[model samples]
Target: MAEPLLDIHGLPGHLIRRLNQIAVAQFMEKMGEIAVDLTPVQYSALCAVKSHPGIDQASIAGLIAYDRATLGKVIDRLEAKGLVSRKVSPQDRRARVVKLTKSGQELLQQVHPVVRAAQGDILTGLDNVEQAQFIALMQKTIQIGNESSRAPQRELGETG
Candidate 1:
């Protein structure tokens, strides 16, 4: 008997998608426990802005591997939350530069430990060594397949 395609247990894409869902759920649950109201993408944006203060919105999209157009909405939400501030870029008047505000920095610091702890739950069945190996493998796979993604991650200094 031919195996059913609907049985996606052995499929990498299906597995990866499931893992992503689990990761996001764990992240949101942990954040909720800590009383922090931030999505994974928003948290990534905050980290990117913190790392490269005054970076343009397009660069942030690249850094975080998020769709550039959609990132605008994400930034708007962050701005509305008073976590980040956006200003017209000095070098490019048309571009908006983003910076994490004091509140954003403080919230990030407060939630850092919670976020780190939440990582363990994402791969709950994996032990310490297995988790490290899985992470390394995932990184390598992502690096190899990055260019194939609709929103591929790019180095901060890389130009399109």
Candidate 2:
């Protein structure tokens, strides 16, 4: 039988949706306070590049849970905006490494405090212990998801 639909008030999916809604709304508001024009996805891409210097475009896409095509467009937009640059990787001529430009670094500096403040606001309800626990649980959940995705496909003659 199919699983029952969850009610909006207390279900896991609903809670996650609500959390995202709140976080995004507050983040935008905080961004306006700091005069940053980038959207959440844009900031995320910028931060990813900043966090993982010398990372390849494909790796950035994987890290951010974005498809290659969509990440390509994002990189294009960032390049157009003078925020990021791509160069042929020294290790692999066929691969392109992505990095933030000076402008992008400056923008990140301007927005980083706002983002930190927003995160602080989000975690305000939780004590340090709870925050740590929450992060641990989230990591565990993601690890489980990764393991399931990497599990071997069943064969016709395979038995478990």
Most TM-score-accurate candidate: 1
Per-residue lDDT, model 2, residue 86, is: 93
What tens-digit string does per-residue lDDT give for candidate 1 at 16-85?
Answer: 9999999899889888888889999999999999999999999999999999999999999999999999
Q: Against the true structure, what is each candidate's TM-score?
A: 0.94, 0.76
Residue-wise lDDT of candidate 2 within 66-125, one digit each (tens)? Answer: 666777888889889999999999999987898899999999999987787678677568
Residue 36 in candidate 1, Cα distance off native in Å:
1.4
Question: CA lDDT, every prediction?
Answer: 0.93, 0.78
**For candidate 2, which ten residues in a row score worst on lDDT?**
151-160
Query: Counting only residues 3 or more apart in sequence or on different chains, how many pairs clash (N, Cα, C under 3 Å) in candidate 2?
Result: 0
